[model samples]
Target chain A: MSRPAGKSKLVRGAQGDWEVVIGMEIHAQVTSKAKLFSGASTEFGGAPNSQVSLVDAAMPGMLPVINAHCVAQAVRTGLGLKAKVNKKSVFDRKNYFYPDLPQGYQISQYQAPVVGEGKVLVDLPDGEIEVGIERLHLEQDAGKSLHEQHPTMSLVDLNRAGVALMEIVSKPDLRSAEEAKAYVTKLRTILRYLGTSDADMEKGNLRADVNVSVRKPGAPLNTRCEIKNVNSIRFIGQAIESEARRQIAILEDGGKIEQETRLFDPAKGETRSMRTKEEAHDYRYFPDPDLLPLELDDAFIASIAASLPELPDEKKARFVKEYGLSAYDAGVLVAERETADYFEQAAKGRDAKAAANFVINELFGRLNKAGIGIERSPVAAEQVGTILALVAEGTISGKIAKDLFEIVWEEGGDPRAIVEGRGLRQVTDTGALEQVIDEIVAKNPDKTAQAKAKPAVLGWFVGQVMRATAGKANPQVVNELLKKKLGV
Target chain B: MSVDAATVRRIAHLARIAVEEGEVEKLKGELNAILGFVEQLKEVNVEGVEPMTSVTPMQLKMRADKVTDGGDAAAVLANAPQTEEGFFLVPKVVE
Candidate 1:
């Protein structure tokens, strides 16, 4: 068995090619101030039990009341995914035994999820492809268990318990690991735009359980392995690559794949099958008796849709049309909402093409090297706009702009103020430039004679004038002055 | 539609209840009797009505997104059988 036919990401086997089917269930923490069913704070990095309420601890006779903001966040996420929002959704109890989960059952949606089918347009290296979203349901996260704290006892932190999570399930539409990565990227961008979730993978807000399976070309999807503990996007791709190959090896050896969950070990770069459960999965799902069914009206959903921010796809298209940016550059700029906002702020009332170059090639490049996010940049977006305006207005040359950017990045001062204080303005004066050209021509007569024959040699004279003035002379003015003086 | 001995034991096992071999038959009878009473609800003709998620005639009451409670770790972990440093301590169950 190999991968799928899409983008020709087929896995080669000993006998023939196989297709790998990939789906994802992303668990994104809902950006809320309180837990789903309690008034406990949802702030990260609080004391272990400081943020947990009695309802979260599953105290006796404690009833669960839903948090309105969490439900709105879930709706906002579904709307951003361009999915159908079910007017009515029920919360069911998923019964299981776990020390981390104080309640024997988890309050989750099983049959009827809040969000229905949706589609995400993933921008792959080859081309753009659409991945179908199966469903997105709201659930509570379990507590964190630390076993290294004690030798024979595990310490459980309930701070994260009862925190709301939107499990966005994707269809088996990704054929390659690249597609998987792009899908997550696009989804995260949309979530950030909606302000529904922080979508930070390192913070455990955005986690994924990737389902990988391999089959023959055009054949039915075979047994798939659900890989959990994938905390980062890089690990998501590696898990898929190794899991696909593992399935291929098994099928080639005439062994049928077992449908079970596995854990990805990034340190080892392989997937390990989880220990078999002592008992079978019997989640006796039923409606939660503590809470009533969630019923949403048309106006509520319409209001959310109306207030929804512009997503990555629409922003990228606008950047291409309005800013005259290349599709690839637009994709990169619009991948993050903050970056896109910065681009607009920098490009406004300036040379947009030059702004794109400055932002993508210069500002972003420097930011990447500094290992800081745009929000933490020393140079503000308005300051960048000032530097670009200086270049466009001939106040400073492009070379001087680099120096100005470096000064601003290091010292955190106004770009215009730094340029003026440092006297980095361009020398467009024709008289001074002519005098400088005369000195260069008088010094290099032999070279001047050669330049008379080949006007292409005028670039050499322009360089000499720029250097004499410490790279402050305007090249266009110097070029014309040199031609008239050299008679070439 | 009916509960078998195996089904009864499976339910008991999932609920983390220890049932003897002889108790399986007795539990099956009890489960069947309870299911019989619930099965009679199927005799009523109630089409087009949505499944009742709650007996009360009201939508789910949702609280505002505010930190109105919590911050007393002592009270939160008071009932725990074993706790240390404001964390509930349980037998190590590593996965």
Candidate 2:
């Protein structure tokens, strides 16, 4: 079979080019105080079983009661995704037996999910692309089974059991690993902005099950293998690349791909078969006998929509329009909710593009090196605002602002106070600057005469004056002073 | 499809129930009988009735979002078959 016309070029293989189709099922823990169906705490790092309630532990005759706030959070997330919130959705029992699952069956949505189709706009290097979300369902988490805790026995931690989770399934729309990574990054940003979940992959709050398959270009879709529970974004890309190569090898050798579940071994950088479809559980899914259908009112959906904070995309657009920032700068500032808030606070009623330069170029670069988040920034937003104000008012040179930033970073203090204490103010006084320029004019008569003749040489005198005054001279004032002294 | 010996064995294994070789025949018969009984529900002529997940005509009971339970380690560990250092112990699960 030949490759499809108008489709992107497929990955080159030994025999021919092969197309890879990728989909992701992301499980993000809902930001809530208690479990989905119990009063137990959903806080991480709790002692084993200490956070478990009777319902979570599956005590006989203990019934599960849904957390109202968790349901609302799920609705909020659906709205954030621009998904359809199903007014009526049913919970089913997915029958499986695992040591971590105290109940033999997990309470999940099988047929009717809470949220319907939606599309995510992934910002790629070329441009923006849309990834379709098939459905999002509410489910309960299983507890942790730790085998490393004991030599001959496993230990169970029930703290995470029954916690609310949203399983977001995507269509097979991703064309490459880079697109997959961008899709996840955009989804995480949206979720964090909605305040529905922290979506911290490091904290185990968000993880993805990646499904990978490869086909002869323009051929029918091939059987897929799911790479299970890849938590980190880097590993997701690695998993896809390795799994695609594996599938291509199998297909080139005239072997059909088997449907299976595989584990991505990060250390080995390969995918190993965890289980084949023949060994998979039937998971006889049926409506849960305990819980009734979840029916949401239009008013409820509207209330959640009304309460949502401005999401990343909207905030980015506003930053570009109102702040006159570059698309790249707006994207960087709005990537995180905290960073966007910080930028808005610092840029409020001021020169926004200048403020953006400081926040994006200076603050973000420092934060990345120091391994800290914008929330843990050494300089406060108000403090940076003060520094930007000083620059705007010409009270301090840009070079002096850098020195002032270094001072505030090391020793916390008011920006104005630090500038005043260290005598870092700009030499905007044209009289004092003119004296310095006059002396330079006498010493470099030849270069001064050349500067008067060829206006480009004026740059050389500007550097000389700046070096003499230690870069504290206001650049515009220095230019005016040099023009007057050189009689250019 | 009718229940068979291999299907019965597989179901038993999935449920983690110990079904001996001698009991497989008996268990298959019992499961087939249950299936036959449930198959009769297809004969009901009600076309427009909504499928019911619960017997009661009520919505799910929702509780306020709060951590009002837990914190009693001893009470939680009381039902465990074995425990050490405040964790429930079981056979090692390598995967």
The CA lDDT at B8 in model 2 is 93
Q: What would you estimate as the lDDT of candidate 2? A: 0.89
- iRMSD (1 decimal) for each model: 1.1, 1.2
Candidate 2, A302-341: lDDT as tens digits = 9988998998888889899988998888988889989999
lDDT of 2 by residue, B6-78 (tens): 9999989888899899999999889988888888877788799988666657777789999888887788779
Which window of ten consecutive residues has the lowest lDDT sum in model 1 chain A?
Answer: A1-10
- Backbone clash count for every predicted candidate, in the order shown: 8, 0
lDDT of each: 0.90, 0.89
List DockQ for all candidates: 0.82, 0.75
Quote the lDDT for A347 in model 1: 89
